[model samples]
Target: MRILLTNDDGFYARGLQTLWQVLAEDETFDVSTVAPENQKSATGHSITLNEPIFVTEQQKKGHKGFAVRGNPADCVKLALQGELIPRPDLVISGINNGPNLGTDVFYSGTVSAAMEGVLLGIPSIAVSLAGYNGDDYEDAARFVHHFLKQNNFIEGGLLNINIPPLPANEWKGVKFTKLGKAVYNNVFEHRLDPRGRSYFWQAGSLAPETDPETDLYALQQEYVSITPMHSDLTDYRKLKI
Candidate 1:
C-alpha cells in the first residue's frame, strides 16, 4: 500500500524520521513523507490561507519527501489536491513528541493533519510515543504497523494512537479508547526577555480527571492507546441535547 506520512513536529524531528525509517524498510508499505518545514505543534487544523503554500521535493534512498512551508494540514491538503502523489492509499501522521488526548486534540497539529486526510476521503492515523513519560518509540512503531496490516483501511478516519513511556515488557498491551479529559493545570506563564519584552506561554500539566476507559487512563496504566478521530465538527452530543 502507498502511505503518505506527515507530522507537526517538522520534517526533521527525530520521531518523524525514525518512523519513516521503520516503515520504509517494510516492503508491505510504500512510504512517502511530506511535512512542515518547521515545527507546527499545537496548531490544530490550521491551513495556509491568503498565501501560497510552497512544496520542495527531496528524494532519499529512492523515497519521496516533501518539505512544505505551511502547517501539517496544509501539507496534506496541498499534496492531495495538487496531485503530488497521484492518490495516496493511506495517511499516517506523527510519532509526535507528545501525547494528544481528549481536549488536547483541539490544539494538536498531529491530530489535525490526520483529520485533513480523513476529510479528503483517505484513511488516516495519528501516533504519539511517550514524550511525557519514558518509553520505546521503536516498539510503538511496530504495534502501529501491525494494526495497519491487520485492518483493511475500509473505514476512512483518523485514529489517534498514544504509546506509554514504559519499556515494552512492562507495557500492558493495547487498548481501544475514547478521548479522556485533560486540561491545563495552570493558567500559563509569562516571562520577560533580556530586551524587557513580556511573553505569555501555555505551561501546565494534565488535569486531574480519570476515566477508566479513556485514552488518558490507558496511558496511565502503561498500555498503548488508540482512539479514532474525525474532522466533522458537528457535535453529535449537542444535537441530542
Candidate 2:
C-alpha cells in the first residue's frame, strides 16, 4: 500500500515520528511524508493561495520526506499537485500531540490534512492521542496499523480516530461515535510587550456537554473513538424545508 503521512504538529513532532517508525516497519507500505515545517495547530482548513509555498527535502535513515513551509492542508495539496510520490492509496494524518474531539475538529489542522486527501477522492484517516502530556505512541500506532491491516479503506469520506492516553489493556474497546458538543471556555488574556504594544493569548478549557455514546464521552472512558467525517457542510435534514 502506498501511504502519505502528515500532521499539524510539524515534521519534527514526536507523534508523527513514532507513526513513521511504526509504519516503516511494514514491508507492504511504501510511505512518504509531507508535513508542515512548523507547528500549525488550530489552523483549520485555511489554504495559502496568495503566497508562494516552499518545500524542503529531508532524509532519515533511508526514508525520504518533505517539509512544507505552509499549513497542514497545504502539505497535502502540494503532495498531490506536485506528484510527490506514487498516487497515494491512503492518506493518514497524525497520531497528533493532542485530542481533536467534537467541535475541536473545526480548528484541527491534522483533520484538515486528511480532509484534503478525501476531497481528492482518496481514503483517509486522522488519528490523535487524546492527551497533551502523553509521550507513548506504541499502542496508538499499533492500533492504526492493525486497523488498516484488518479493514479495507472505505473511500468517499474519512475516519477520525482518537485514542485514549492509556495502555491497550486499559481501553474499554473501540466505539464508532458521533461528534459531541465540546466548546471551550473562551478567554483572552491581554498583555503588553516591552514596546508597550497590546497582545492577547487565547486560552480555555473543554466545556463539552457529553453523552455516553459520543466521541467526547468515549474518550473520557478510555475507549478508542472513530467518528466518520466529511467535507460537505450541508445540513441535509433541512433540505426538505
Candidate 3:
C-alpha cells in the first residue's frame, strides 16, 4: 500500500513520528510524510490561497519527510496536487496529540487533512490519541498499522478514529460510533497585552460525554472509536420539507 501520512501537530511531533516508524516497519507499505512545519492544531480545512507556501526537505530523528509552512489541509493539498510525492493509495492524517471526538471534527486540522484526501478521490483516516498530557502513542500507532493491514481501503471514504488513553491490554476493543455533541463552557478573558492593549483570550472546557453510541462515550469507556465521515454537510432528513 502506498500511504501518505500527515498531521496538524507538525512534522516533529512524537505522535506522527511514532506512527511513521511503525508503519515503515511493514514491508508491504510504502509510506511518505508531508506535514506542517509548525503546529496547526484546530485550523480546520483552510488552505493557503494568497501566500506562497514554503516547503523544506527535512530529516530528523531518523525520519525523512517534507515540512510545509502551512496548515494540515495545505500539506495534503500540495502533496496530492503538486509533485511533492507520488500519488498515494491511502492518506492517514494523524496519530494526533489530542482527541478529535464528537463535534471537534468540525474544527480539527487532523480530520481536515484526511478530508482533503477524500475530496481528492482517495481513502483516508484520521487517528487521534484521546489525551492532551499523554505522550505514549505506541499503542495507537500500532493499532493504526494493524487496522490498515486488516481492512481494504474504500475509495473516496473517510474515517475519524479516536483511541482511548490506555494501554493496549486495557482497551475495551473498537467500536463503530456516531458523532456526538461536544458542548463547551466558553469564556473570553479580557486582559492587557504588553503595550497595555486590551485583548480577549478565548477558552472553554468540554462537557462530559453521555450518549452511549457516540464517539465521546466510546473513548470514555476505554474503547477505540471509529466514526466514518464524509464531506457532505447536507441534512438529508430535512430535504423532504
Candidate 4:
C-alpha cells in the first residue's frame, strides 16, 4: 500500500516520528510524509492562500519526507495537488500528541488533514492519543499500522481514531463511536506585552463525558474510539422535515 502520512504536531514530533518508523519498517507499505514545519495544532482546515507555501526535504529515523511551512491541510493539499509525493493509496494524519475527540475535531488540524484527503477522493484516517504530556506513542502507532494492514479502505471514507494512553493490553478494546459534546469552560487570560500591548491567551477545560456511545466516553473507559466522519455538514434530519 502507498501511504501518505502527516500531522499537525510538526515534522519532528515524536508521535509522528514513531508512526513513521512503524509504517516505514513494513515492506508491503510505501510511506511518505509531509507535515507542518512547526506546531499547527487547532488550525482546522485552513489553507494558505495569500502567502507562498514553502517545503523542505527532511529526514527522521532514516526516513525521508517533506516539511511544509504551512498548516496540516496545506501539507496534504500541496502533496496531492502539486504532486509532492506520488498519488497515495491512503492518507493517514496523525498519532497526534493529544486527543481530538468530539467537537475538538472542528478545530483540529490533524483531523482536517485527513478530511482534506477525503475531499480529494482518497481514503483517510486521523489518529490521536488521548493524553497531553505523554511522549510514548508506540501503542498508538502500532495500532495504526495494524489497522492499515487489516482493513480495506474505500474512497471518501474518513475515520477519526482516538487511542487511550494506556498500554495495549490494558485497553478495553476498540469501539465504533459517535462524536460527543465537548463542553469546555473557556477562559482568555488578559495580559499586556512588554511593549504595553494587550493580548489574551485562550484556554479551556473539557467537561467529563456522560454519553456511552460517544468517542469521549470510549476513551474514558480505556477503549480505542473509531468515529467515521465525512465532509458534509448538512442537517439531514431538518432537511427531510
Q: What is candidate 3's local distance difference test score?
A: 0.94
Compare candidates 1 and 2 on TM-score and give the better one: 2
Estimate, for each residue in 11-129, the C-alpha lDDT of model 2 and write its tens digit.
98889888899999999998999999999999998999899999999877765899999999999988987787778989999989989999889889999999999998898999999
Candidate 2 all-Cα RMSD:
1.3
> Model 1 scores what on Cα lDDT?
0.85
lDDT of 1 at 162: 91
Q: What alpha-carbon RMSD in Å does predicted model 1 have with respect to the real structure? A: 2.0
Q: Enumerate residue pairs that collide in model 2.
A: none
lDDT of 4 at 70: 99
Q: In candidate 1, residue 60 scores what lDDT? A: 59
What is the C-alpha lDDT profile of model 4 across 28-119, one tens digit per residue? 99999999999999999999999999999998558799999999999999999999999999999988999999999999999999999999
- After aligning candidate 3 to the native by TM-score, how far in Å is the CA of 165 from where it should be? 1.2
Output the number of the TM-score-best candidate. Answer: 3
Per-model lDDT? 0.85, 0.91, 0.94, 0.94
Candidate 1 local lDDT, 1-241, one digit each (tens): 9999999989877777778888888898888888998989999989877998888887655656999999999989988997787688999998898888887898999998998999999999999986754345787777777788789888687789998866677888889999887866776778899999999987677766578899988888888898977666797898898
- Which scores greater on TM-score, model 1 or model 4? 4
TM-score to native of every candidate shown: 0.92, 0.96, 0.97, 0.96
Poorest 10 consecutive residues by lDDT, candidate 2? 204-213
